[model samples]
Target chain A: MAHTGKILVTGSGIDLTLLRPLEEAGNSIVARPKLLSAAELKAELRDAVAYLHGGEEYASGDALSTAESLKVVAFMGIGYESFVDVDAAKERGLRVTWTPARRPDAVAVFTLGQIIYANLGIRNRLDERYPPQWSAAVPMPSELSAQRVGIVGLGSIGSRLAGLLLTIGCEVSYYSRTRKLAETTLDLTYRTLPDLAAWSDILVVLLPENPSTVNIIDTSVFARMKEGSILINTARAALVEPVALGNALRDGTIAVAAIDGHYRDESVNAALMREFGPRLLWTAHVAAHTRQSMAAMVDQAVRSVLRALDNAPDENMAVGQ
Target chain B: MAHTGKILVTGSGIDLTLLRPLEEAGNSIVARPKLLSAAELKAELRDAVAYLHGGEEYASGDALSTAESLKVVAFMGIGYESFVDVDAAKERGLRVTWTPARRPDAVAVFTLGQIIYANLGIRNRLDERYPPQWSAAVPMPSELSAQRVGIVGLGSIGSRLAGLLLTIGCEVSYYSRTRKLAETTLDLTYRTLPDLAAWSDILVVLLPENPSTVNIIDTSVFARMKEGSILINTARAALVEPVALGNALRDGTIAVAAIDGHYRDESVNAALMREFGPRLLWTAHVAAHTRQSMAAMVDQAVRSVLRALDNAPDENMAVGQ
Candidate 1:
């Protein structure tokens, strides 16, 4: 076990102080101060046995062609969809891993907040009430404990969120690609996508953005949702059709929509704001921005790379086949 | 068991159906459609043995002098301070009660939401980003699990909120008039107001508003609080000095303030908004406005009156000495 391997950290703005644990473990660190092209990265990758990756560079094709010694590449964030070419890495026999799924606790709490915010109509109240007209007749919000909440994704974040909602006595149901066989013991009911949409008083979207999920919730899904139901999206904007959502909110098909993520284009935000205005509550994709989550993600990424370099088995670290 | 007592319900907008539970128990119901004068209430009080009160007409001296047969008076909502004259009720041998202690679970969840909201700087990020300038360099919010949270009051709502925060792994401390005897087993430390302010990265105000609590969090307390700390108030607006809070937020003494309650004045809200628009996250005092809480309050108020009429030794239900 007397190995001094070179671990390359790709991308800038990473607080290198957090990687102190890796350095103290007797690894030689090579960090790229800026994002490099495939040609530039190949030279650095040639000698490094491990890499901590953050840039949007596709890692399998030309990027990994010269990395003869490379055994592992660890993505620093939860989502590795467009950031890495996992199939190519699999083909090359290189281990690939991503950080813990979406900082489960942070996202879960944020999801609960969004649910409360939407059901309570806080945004509309904030917008309309400059000097909130004191009224006992303020609309009574449906209790979280009394309503049926249906989640679209039941991954780590969604599962944790389901537990939180259950703690508040919400009747929880979820729709995933497959039934969560491991979590059958939880107090969650499994339903088909359309059934879930139709049943939910509040439908939460937590599915990761992927080729199969793009525009998954459109006019059809909106039409199927219960009348005056709410929508909360914390996962990705690509999963929802903004135009359809805007119409639903305006026509009261949806009572409210609390979104923390949007399409990468600024125009989408502008359009949503223009159409929905105060009917939409926005947070800047900050569900996973907690200091603890960020630190844990980096620490785990470093550990995964170290585990790979030492030939230790990592059943959960590797992302795809 | 043959009691055909008359129960008078004061104030407008009380759902008549909630009183059906009392009527089913063989009580005749009388509801005041609007705020009544002392003379009007005296006439209603002549026949009524139990009362559900809402209007601010003080029940003291002359008001209680006329309520000859009134054995119990229940405040329809939690706050009973300015609504009832406790000394008068006690002298007149009448029991007074208030319903649903801020819906402990509802307020606890809302308090946690405010902590996360303030710590995450959701409003600031929303104001600054359009479609979010995606960056790994996003400001890292202090983790809820990693920091110390100081609560100003550890009553039902605060005690429940402390438990919720503890579940999230926060190091919790509090400053109450007296240490909560029941919560000595909880992982909470009792601290002086100044010490709690100095030690906390997030200070929560849940104190019931009284003559003693008004303007308790003045400039001196703000000075004692840790720099970059956040404030959350779900209790009362009078507890915080808006001018001082605005100054702290503007000067960066406090990073953010999330408030759910405020002084019922248009000018105060306008002034606070004009000073710290984005930094002050506002929720319209709807923390306990859930349908579940509302129904529970009404149900409990009815039950308390029934219990009082039955000659039951109910010490806690009677609020005044």
Candidate 2:
């Protein structure tokens, strides 16, 4: 059983609550502290059947390619692109799967929370606490109900976000890939991206990053935007051209913006700050991170491993279920 | 008419939006640039007919005692204790009036927002953006439905906070000065402060500061609190005794706490940080500062000023309005 070489769980920040079943079933589990560089990773994966990619494994591409004996790579999230080399892994008879990183409730709550915090100026209040007995600097942020919110993508997160925004009396509209069916929970209107930009007092980027969406919010989209609008990004960074965003912020094209998902490094955030200015309220890529979601993600990961061990079929796989 | 004598609004951050009406009413309003000290304020108020207190004006009794012909000491807010000698002003035929600050909508929004941020670990995501990358932090925050909340000092802000919390499925309980009448909007159980502390997973303090309430949450209260319970103070700082709070957090008797109304200076916050570990989230007194509330506050201020002009007899008169 020790020589079975059944599974490998790579990365940190993973809840091992679900992975216990496979370990209990007498399948050999190879656990690294977290994802190391390619050399260190190659040393760890001498005999592992299925590969698990957690948060850190997605940082770079080198360690991913070295897991030679890996048959399946089941990502703990919908973002398999970060860790899975689609082209390289396809050539190696490797099947990649993902748990749709959809925590609609969590994201909806967070969106509403940030909406109030941004509108109500929680950051300014926090900063006032760090001062020289000064209280005049805090900006009393405005109300979201009085704000016109335009979302670029009306997919799952965006649609749910639209509902939350509506509950707070925000005027909501969105741009989607295809026309939506009919009337829905939110008072939503479909508009061209540019038109949406022009109308919105706050433009939140929630579009998925694909060939169509890559830098979709470039100069033209920003050029049509209202002067004092705020840009909030919980989506992929590349969805908006960073250069255009910086220029927009600098030139009074936007008043102030708050973001929850951007680069996970200081240098990157610093560069973003240099360009976009420190006015960007930042959080790491944790838009949908509720404990419920993480626990659900681990359950899915364990199922994938158990399926592979039992040689049974698993559906709902992102790339190849 | 020009010699009506200048009504000196000496406090900085004295609602510009509110003063617009006074300016338009032909009352020449000269706005101060900053929160002035007692000496600077005396110089500024040499010829002032009425002096508005923005923050604490004097540390001692004589500051207000010696000022002759300072007829009205009008306040922009309810915290007149910070800036005025109420009894002394009464003796001097100096009328001091204040706008009662209450914003259920704003406090409801902020309390819920901070609660979500705290129990859900919003700062973790904020921390994830920097040196400790998002992936390195595991067990992402939990959802609100899973949290157990307790409210202390269930006054206006706390009561409204409880209503909001109940609407969102929080296991809400409260401890007020007296028991509240039954209301289904908040299925709130009235608990003794000790019972509330013991049963609550998160304790939200919304008490006012006074001799009776000061250090009310000292070692005994912290000891009564459940392990890993969080403390939130949008009310007053003296409600919590920091030494006990530090000990609780350090020994894991309590987990973390957030205070938005305690520190008057960064040095005080810094001193707290030095005394207590950084498990505390310190912010300036800005819980009731949405734009809507600011506008409302200023509106009330204008009304008070106008009521004096209207020559209407009214109740709750501070400075013989």
Q: Which candidate leads in DockQ?
A: 2
lDDT of 2 by residue, B279-307 (tens): 66666566655667667766666656545
State interface RMSD in Å for all models. 4.9, 4.2
DockQ of 2: 0.34
Q: How does model 1 score by TM-score?
A: 0.75
Each model's total of backbone clashes: 0, 2
Query: Residues A241-310, candidate 2, lDDT per residue (tens digit)?
Result: 7778778888878767767655424466577676654466666556656768667777887777667555
DockQ for all models, in order? 0.27, 0.34
Where is model 2 chain A poorest over a 10-residue stretch in terms of lDDT?
A: A127-136
Q: By summed lDDT, which 10 consecutive residues of candidate 1 chain A come out lowest?
A: A127-136
Every prediction: chain A TM-score: 0.76, 0.83
